[model samples]
Target chain A: MHFMTALKAAWRQRDSLLCVGLDPDPAKLPAHLAGQPEAIFEFCREIVDATADLACCFKPQIAYFAAQRAEDQLEALIEHIHRRHPEVPVILDAKRGDIGSTAEQYAIEAFERYGADAITVSPYMGRDSVEPYFAYPDKGVILLCRTSNAGGSDLQFLDVGGPAGQERLFERVARLVAEEWNTGGNCGLVVGATFPDEIARVRQLTGDLPLLVPGIGAQGGDIEATVKAGCSADGSGLMISSSRAILYASRGEDFAEAARRVATATRDAINVHRPT
Target chain B: MHFMTALKAAWRQRDSLLCVGLDPDPAKLPAHLAGQPEAIFEFCREIVDATADLACCFKPQIAYFAAQRAEDQLEALIEHIHRRHPEVPVILDAKRGDIGSTAEQYAIEAFERYGADAITVSPYMGRDSVEPYFAYPDKGVILLCRTSNAGGSDLQFLDVGGPAGQERLFERVARLVAEEWNTGGNCGLVVGATFPDEIARVRQLTGDLPLLVPGIGAQGGDIEATVKAGCSADGSGLMISSSRAILYASRGEDFAEAARRVATATRDAINVHRPT
Candidate 1:
């Protein structure tokens, strides 16, 4: 099935807009898992088991695993998650961007090697850096725009001189990407939940394109405002992601259950604000 | 030693400003080494061996290796180059930009795992993302500004309405980074060779911050103009990089020798335009 269709199906079945961000920071892992690569795998496995029903999707930030040189363990953990719960789509949060040729290799790694239903990309290198990823009909490419950090406004919100006299850089990027780059419906934009006004403006410019709304949890973004700003015309297409708030819900042995409770609260909050 | 001091020492020893970019595309490798990962390692090893004496530094673009899932090979290649030719500096060309916490992990990976003398970073995430890399006093952190690609101007040159009214985004980034982020002179900016006017402007803002200027070869950037635009007041803070134009100089067995000739020519061209 296509990535969009699969995402929609998962959202409907789980009745959740929450995407549990699996950013397994080894330093912050439960004491039982300290210094054990296998423990990392076990921690992820337990989290997935507990919150599989509460999450619409699972986003594994590749950097956490890549940093540890735990490629084999990461692969094992991902395989375990997919094998056991085939219904939940995995969005690999690897903000990779490169030239056309190199981009192809990353596409292969994300889709073929890691089996990610969607991957995040940095748009700094321009459209060619992203076009290669669209060759995969079943994978979605989410471009970074208006990140959830305080410093994001430094460049992203700059008043770039455009035909409209003055416009925010992210608005122009959103327009260009929506009109020019969305040859297929596989394109999405990552608008941080922290900026609801920008998110609303970007949603208007993007039309039907999906929005991956990260920063709902540990980033301290207001959940109600994010849902109102990012929900599509049909009241879908927002993947509200929460990493540390959910993954490190507790540093004790009961971390998995704490994670589930947090995921459940996030899901309930989204449903409360979600359009009927 | 401080990064600037090391850069100056390399420049004095080689009497050259050349920083060879090792971006070996798997598809572009010689026919004999097609479909083999070891070929990339061999190809990079040969280039490093051939040009170690002629060049001051070697910049291996992380994307090229990362696109191939060849990080291990890249680590080994960098270690080999350093072991065999300790005089030359190895700059890892990875434009990594993430949150402060994530950036710490990346710093550890780039400096500790790969042992890079300097690593390139994307300043899009703000000062927090970049400051973590500077925690290591000896390692250099090169920030992206005024990139060489055609679409770079789409955002980098945007009129960001800041305290400096109508300032270009990259110019603002350069000024803020130089003033605030460079506490140890370990900070640098990547001012592309393609834009001489922008380079000269950024050069003034950067003051003594070392600049890694890519787009010299294969990208059609003028060598003399780049040197004139980027040379520091002291004639000691620029590292001009070229990749395919040198490494893929020949497709035959004599490829290494061909690379050497190109490196010599590139080095000579930079020397001719060096600020007296």
Candidate 2:
């Protein structure tokens, strides 16, 4: 199925807009799973099994895995999750961006190497650096806009010359991407839940384009305001993601259950504010 | 040696500011060495050996090697080149940028995995994304400012608010990075050769910060003008780079020799215009 359709189905079945991020830090993993790749895999599998009913999708931050030299194992783990929960979408939060030709190779890696339903990208290098990812008919490309971190406003909120003489860079990017790059409705924007006003503004600019709202959990972003600001007019296009908060919900044997509890709370909170 | 000192030494020894980029395309490699990773290694070794005396530094665009699933071979190639000619620095042209924690992992990859003397980075993610790279005192971080590409102006030249009210985003980044991020002198700016005015402006803003100027040879940038615009006041701190035009000088048996010839010519051209 296409990414959008699959996303829609996930939302309907789970009744949630939450995308649980599986950023398994070895140091934060349960003591039994600390160093063993198999333990890590089993831990993630259990978490997936426990929270599959609550999350619309799963976003595995690739850096945490790549940093551990567990890239191959992470790929296998993601494949396992996809195979087990065929209805749930998997977004690879890689944030990769490079020159035109290089981006194509990354596209192959994100889409072919791991079979990701969606991938996050950095928009620092402009359109050519991003267009290659769109070549995949089934994958969604989530471009970083207003990130949740404190320093994010330093660059994303810059002013740029536009049809109206001046406009915020992220707003301009949102408009241009929505109009020019959304050829297949597979393009999305990442607007951190921390910036509700900007989120509302970007939502207006992007029309029906899906917004991946990160920063809700560990980043101190408000879930209710984010859901109200990010959900599309028809109530579907927001992938509210939480990583550290859910992944390390408990540092003990009950970690997977703790994860399910957090995912359930986040999912229920979003459902309360999800546009009708 | 400090990055600036090494750059100055390279400039003085070769009497040239040329830094040839060693971006080997598998399809464009000599037919005699086709389809073999060993052949790719051999080709890179020959080119480095032949041109070591002429070029100031060798920049291996990581993407070209990564595209072929030959990144390990490329790492071996870099180690081989560095061992053969220890004076010539290897700048890994990977424009990597991520959050602070992730950037630390990338720093380990670039400095430890490949032992790159310098690495290029995109500044779109702001200060925290780049600070971790500076933790290693010996290595250098070259921030991407105005690029040589046609579409680079699309965002790099946007107006970001600064102490000067409104300035080109690249110029603002140059000033901010030089003042705030260059405390250890390990930070540099990537100002493309294609834009002489921007290069000059950035050079002035950056002061003594080393500039890695790409887009010289096959990209059609003017070498003499770029050197004049990019060089520090002391006639140093510039690593003018060219990739495709140097590495793929010929697609035949004498490809390495042809690469050396073109590199020598580029070096000679830069020598003619160096400030006394």
Candidate 3:
């Protein structure tokens, strides 16, 4: 199945738009899992088991794994998620960009080596850097549109001249992704949930294309406002991601159950604001 | 020593501005080395040894190594470079960006795990994402500005209002980087050798900051024009990078010798245009 089809199926199956970011920090893992070589993998495995039923997808930030030289563990974790929760999609939050040939190798790393259903990319390098990812029609190429960080405004908000007069860099990116880049129909945007207004603006620009919205929980974005601004007309296209808030809900032995409770509440809260 | 001082010292010692990219593609490796699990390492190791004395630095694009699950080789290559050619810097071509905490992890991956003297980064996510790399005062953090690829024009060329007047996105990036982001003095820019005009513009914006210029050789960049446009007043600030044209100069057993020949020619070509 294509990435969009699989994503929609997962969304329907879980009845949730929550994507738990499995960005494990060794400093924050349960004390028992601390100092263990397999701590990152063990903590992520438990988190997936606890919240897989409540999430539409799981986003494993590659930095956390790569930091500890745990790419082997990352590959294993993705395979485990696929085996355990076949319906849930996995998105690797690795904002990679390079020249054409190098981009192909990166695509292989994200899709072939790790088996991620979706991968994030940066549009700074232009079309050739991103086209390689489109070869996998079944995989999602999520581009950074409007990020949640304060520095995002540094470049993304610049007003550039376009065919339709002046448009912000992020708006231009959303338009280009929707019109020029989504030929395979697997392209999506990473618009931060923290920017509810920009979320609405990106939605207006891209229509019903999937938006992997990050920056919700620990980043202090309002879930109600995010759902109100980011949802498609049919009410089902946004995937609001939360990491630290859910991952480190409690630093104790009950971390898994605590994660479950927070995941469930987040899902329920999003659904309440979601259109009927 | 800081990254700039080391780079200048290496440039002066080598009497060249050439930076050979160690992007090893398995399919393109010598037939004898193919199918060998250590092909990536052997190809890169041979290429480095052959060209080390002729070049100023060695850049290993991480994607090729990661695709073949040869990060161990990547580490080995960096160690080999540091041991064999201590004066020549190794810039890991990883255009990584993320949130703050994750950026720190990426810093660890590039500096700690791979032991690269410098690493490339994407400025898309703003200041925070690029700041972590600056933590290492001795390490170089090269940012992508005007890339050589066609897609680079997609976003990098868009004109936006700046302090003085309308400025292209890449120009704005160059200015911001030179003005604000180089507090640690370990900053550099990746301006494609393909775009000489933009390289000149970036040089004007960032006076003496080192420029890592790719898109030469196999990418069809003009060396004379690149040096004429990108070099500092002293003719030593630009590192002209070429990968395939030098690494795969021959497909047979003489690949190493062929690479050395190409490296010498490229360095001599750049020197002819360098100012005395």
Best candidate, TM-score: 3
lDDT of 1 by residue, A93-114 (tens): 8777655655787787788777
Model 2 misplaced regions, further than 4 Å: A37-43, A161-166, B37-42, B161-166
What fraction of the reference structure's interface contacts does model 3 contain?
Answer: 0.90
* Candidate 1 chain A, run of 10 with poorest lDDT: A96-105
Stretch of 10 with least lDDT, candidate 3 chain A: A1-10
- Against the true structure, whose DockQ is highest? 3
Candidate 1 wrong stretches, greater than 4 Å: B31-37, B162-165
Question: lDDT per prediction?
Answer: 0.84, 0.81, 0.92
The positional error of residue B229 in candidate 1, measured at the CA in angstroms, is: 2.0
What TM-score does chain B alone reach in each candidate, compared with the true chain B? 0.96, 0.96, 0.98
| Full ranking by TM-score | 3, 1, 2
Q: What TM-scores do the predictions have?
A: 0.94, 0.92, 0.99
As a TM-score, model 1 comes out at 0.94
Put down candidate 3 lDDT per residue, B1-276, tens digits, no spaces: 566787899899989899999999988999889999788888999999999888888899999998989999999889988888888889999999887888999999999998888999999989888998988889999999999998899999999988878899999999989999988888999999889999999999999899999999888899999999999988799999999999899999999999999999999999999988
Candidates 1 onward: DockQ, in order: 0.47, 0.48, 0.90
lDDT tens per residue, model 1, B95-115: 788777777878878888888
